[model samples]
Target: MGVSKLDILYRRLLLTKLFIRGWGRPEDLKRLFEFRKMIGNRERCQNLVSSDYPVHIDKIEEQSDCKILDGHFVSPMAHYVPDIMPIESVIARFQFIVPKEWNSK
Candidate 1:
């Protein structure tokens, strides 16, 4: 089977000359981190910082110049909300009180 997209995205870029050299290119690094964050993959962000770069994960403070990508950026409210029925129909059926003053038309 082919490697999954998630697998590729989370692949370790550390010790790679290309990645180390491109560390200064925030334009490139930003998107990778952003996508990872969007998908709530904290590991990817941590890997980028601790593995992709020359510095160790523990040396975050020492490498003040490097922008630290934290996985906590992922929203805690990130969860699936399934829609079982049309929102408008649900609102019309379940609305307890309809204001007389409000235009029903």
Candidate 2:
């Protein structure tokens, strides 16, 4: 994840952090909340829609880009940070294991 700070994706990631923690300008927050709710609902229904469609599943391990990061956060601070420091910003990244293929250029 060697993304530069000036990159647009990096900015979007910062915006995502703000949106998730319910902090931002009113108009931006409104739009973010709207889209967040829409996407959240769509993700929530994915399992139901998949069951209905009953599409064939692929053996993803055979794919050329199939790399899974198997890991979990030990101490996620985002949940409790807001309560202590209302104005402070928080960005967290955890170490995870990814296939060598993915790490290779």
Candidate 3:
């Protein structure tokens, strides 16, 4: 029943309020778009922009000064990889590539 509600909502401030910036502020979010951002493609975003979620690539640009929480908008290779993986991990993996020379270093 956990996934029964396919949507969760939280805002940008929640991260700060929880970690470094403390204030007992266990936040209440009307919606939380926790899904991973695909790597920089405009087409996919065009499709998802109409989706019911709040945190899609298209939506971020609408904000006055939207601060990207962790990574950049990754819409390029959305369908190429597994969808079930955590968004952060997917992005981090994509952001970093182990150099072949590092093994020798």
Query: What digit string (tens of lDDT, one per residue) describes model 2 on residues 69-92?
Result: 332331222342232323333432
- Candidate 1 has a TM-score of 0.19
Return the TM-score for each candidate structure: 0.19, 0.23, 0.16
Report the Cα RMSD per candidate.
22.7, 17.1, 16.3
lDDT of 1 by residue, 1-105 (tens): 355777666455532566658543444454545554544666544543333323223212223333332221212112121232234433221112223354566
Please identify which of the two predictions, 2 or 3, would achieve the higher lDDT against the true structure: 2
Residue-by-residue lDDT tens digits, candidate 3, 33-96: 3323432345655775445523333222223433333233443334343443356654432222
lDDT of 1: 0.39
Q: Which candidate has the top score in lDDT?
A: 2
**Candidate 2's C-alpha lDDT?**
0.43
lDDT of each: 0.39, 0.43, 0.37
Clashing pairs in 2: none
lDDT-based ranking:
2, 1, 3
lDDT, candidate 3, residue 57? Answer: 36
Q: How many residue pairs clash in model 1?
A: 0
